[model samples]
Target: SLKIVFNFQAGFGILANMFLLVFYTFIILCYRPKPTDMISCQLTFIHIVLLLTGGNIWLWDIFGSLNIENDFNCKATFYISRVMRSLSICLTCLLSVFQAVTISPSSSFLAKFKYKLKKYMISVFLFIWSFNVSFTSHRIIYSGIFTNVSETKQMKVTKSCSLLSMNYIIRALILTVIISRDVFLVGLMLATSAYMVIILFRHQRQHKHLHNLSHLRASPEKRATQTILLLVVSFVVMYWVNIIISSTAVLLRMYDPVILSVQKFVMNVYPTITPLVQISSDNRITNMLKHIQSLCHHIFKKR
Candidate 1:
């Protein structure tokens, strides 16, 4: 039952992210893409790949036929997934910071920094990719299948590749690195999101007498900022929930299948919802979708 639930969730997540990937790619190709759009496109593309890879692993685990049991395949999937997850958080932070900087008052320090950073956006993206890849290299080295012996004198092979460290000191160091990286990224995302929210609030307050309107309806920048904030909040919530569940499982040394399924479901939630939020908030995508629907309707009417 848990396996069925996981497969269902993974299938839905893959389809959603695949549509997002294609939509963003269309935007990049047909529309004048902003820096934010480019970032979103890259993020969506990564999500699609991650979802496909993750879904395959889950399906394989259920069917028990696909031969992904080798060390190389395990390391590749584990490493790529870890790197992509970290990259997703970093890209989200970049998106929030970019939106915040774009919406900052012209005379503010952020405005100045934004001006300086605009010319080197590609370089910044490259740095993020390199840094995350280098940082997560340890996963490739530490992840492999291991055998465990139960008290009943029965030996079982672990189904999935996981981090294996016999040395306590080495394990501690790895754990420290992983935890610190996650904390730093999550902190950065929260701070940037908070700053953007404050800026939006002040702007709205200053114009309160003009008209009462939601921040999302105020301006394009505000709408984009609000959308990014929503994305960040959802990502952080799901990310931390998965983290907490996994950490608890690790600490208790208990591998409850239901708990693991719940963790994966939580982790997939953000990817599933991100595209929906993006399309709903952006008038261009919504307009494009509507146009497509109308065209199909008209063609059917002619038939």
Candidate 2:
């Protein structure tokens, strides 16, 4: 039953993320893409790749069997998954910061910074990838298949792909690196989101009369800002919950299959929900879907 559940979750996540990737590719090719849209497209692409790679690993774990066994598979899966997961978090943080800067008052320092950042957005993305790859390189070096022996009188051998043993110093270093990276990215996202809220609040207070006159009116930027804010909030909540569950499991040395399955499910919730949130919040995508539906209805009526 758990295996069936995992398979279903993995299948759904992969399909959903793939749809998001295709939709964004269409938007970029057919429409004038904004900086935020570009970032979102890239983020969606990463999510698709991550889901493909990580989902396979989870499936293997669920089945408890593999047709082919190799150390390379273990290393490749761990390396790609770690790098892509970090990249996903960093890209989301970039999205939040980008939206905050976009909504800043024109005369503020953030507005000037935004213009400069826009000029080097590609460079910034390159830097993020390079930094994450470099830091996550240890996964490739320290992860491989390990052989475990049963403690019974009749020794039984079990081969599993996981983190290989290392010296205490090296282990500590890697743990520190991961924890620090997560803290920095999460902190940056929270700070930028809080700042954006403050700026929006002030603007609302200052333009209270204008807002009253046009109560239902919201600019595109405002809508985008709200969407991104919600995405960030949701991501933060899922991230922390996953973190707590994972940390507890690790600290307690609880390696039960059910516990592991729950952890995997928690880890996947954010990516699974992200594309849905993006599609529902963006008016263009919703409008495009409505247009297509109407066109199909008209054609059928003529027939």
Candidate 3:
């Protein structure tokens, strides 16, 4: 059941993310590229890579093949996946914060950032990629083929690649840094989410007296903020669930097969649900799908 669940998560997640990535790519190219769309496109690409690496879709099978016979495969898979996961968190946080800033009231301090945020997004992406790569480089040194020794303890990540133990001081320090990073990002997301809620509430109060029905339709900014808030909430929920499963495994010093699989499910949950939520919320995607459907229908009629 665990294996079945994991496979479902991985399969569905990759497909959903691919669907969003293509749509976002088209939007970026054929239309005016919004900052959120660009960030989401990049994030979709990152999730695809994550699904490939950590999603157990290809990495295990590919590395298990005879063509690859070294610890290099293990190091590369864990390191790359780790980097991508870290990047995903950063990008999600960026999206949430960007949306918050996008919707800020004109009189607020956050309003000052609204104009310049889009211009510097690419730079932010580059910096985050570099930072995560460097921060997770330690994974390379600690990941290798699992050697079964009855007397020795190890965290078996896969049939082949496992996490070798690190020095106490080094391990503690790295764990601390990683924890700190997650906490800070999660905190920022919460803060921005709160700010957005306040903004939305005030927006309603300010507009309450007006008889105009025009405000009934959500503006692009409002829609974007609501979508991002949903994503941030989803991300935070999955992150904590995955962290709990992982911490439990680490504390007991044994990665039970069930626990590990649950962790995978938890990790994949966010990526799988994200695109679906975005697709449901975005009218543009709905229109795009409708356009394609009508075009296909017209072609069939002609045939």
Candidate 4:
């Protein structure tokens, strides 16, 4: 029953995410996503995929049984969900790097590489997909159609299967790579955000800056920078909290289901929260609301 409710909630969440993605795409299409806007669009698209994958898994788990007839569907569902979740995490790291690069100062050598790298975005995205697919194929090896016997027995029966021992060193290497990537991107976000804040502060201190203050204050680029800063801060805080808990659990070799559940919840919640944050702050949505109000008033006058 709880699982069913979770699926329903996830479905609603995915719907909301899709609506936001479309709205943002429209903004990008009409104006077209600048190279910078492309980062947000890609993140939003990945986020939608993550939510849909999760929701489908839950829905199928509740409503679709794992029979031989449905075994392929089950495998496909799990595979796609795992791939999408991993891709979302990977793409988020890319998004941070992309944004940081976009805002890099012209004096910085890094800025010179931006034009060269601009053409590689699609290629990079394709690489991300291929990387995730290669790693997540392990799901196919481990999961299969299960046969359940009399009230208490269930088996992950496999056909002529030889168990391959897990290489702890290899697993550790993969984990280290993921963590290193996250840490690097987080550091970049910190540096870029700090630079932006310092620039704003210095501008505020200039006495001659007063006359142009209103214009500077209303600059879209500044607002966008501030928004990215907020995202970076929230991501760092939440991610570190999870990291601390997760590292402790892994080091201690704690296998308590409750602890595992909490860890999983922490992972899911971040993506769920992001769309809400974006919608709550979207000025374009507010402007659309005002436009709707004006149209209503105009209709009433015509009546």
Question: What local distance difference test score does each model get?
Answer: 0.77, 0.78, 0.84, 0.62
The window of 10 residues in a row where model 4 has the poorest summed lDDT is: 154-163
Q: 1 or 4: which has the higher lDDT?
A: 1
- TM-score of predicted structure 3: 0.92
Off by over 4 Å in 4: 1-12, 28-30, 55-57, 60-78, 143-165, 206-216, 244-257, 300-303
Per-residue lDDT for 1-303 in model 3, tens only?
A: 665666777888899999999999899889998888989998899888888777474555565576684688888888988999999999999999998898887888999998788778778888998999999999999888777774155677665667888899999999899999999999999999999999998887787787475648777777878889999999998888888887898787754777867777777778888888889899999988999999999999999
Each candidate: RMSD: 3.1, 3.5, 2.3, 5.5
lDDT of 1: 0.77
lDDT of 4: 0.62
* Deviation in Å, model 1, residue 182 alpha carbon: 2.0
Q: Per-residue lDDT for 86-197 in model 4, tens only?
A: 7765666665566556666788766886876688877887898888899778766544455443312222212211113246786677668767766776777677667767
Give the count of colliding residue pairs in each prediction: 0, 0, 0, 1
TM-scores, all models, native as reference: 0.88, 0.89, 0.92, 0.72
Residue 247 lDDT in model 1? 77
- Model 3 CA deviation exceeding 4 Å by range: 55-58, 65-70, 149-153, 211-215
TM-score computed on alpha carbons, candidate 1: 0.88
Q: How many backbone clashes does candidate 2 have?
A: 0
Which one is best on lDDT?
A: 3
lDDT of 1 by residue, 177-198 (tens): 8888788878988998999989
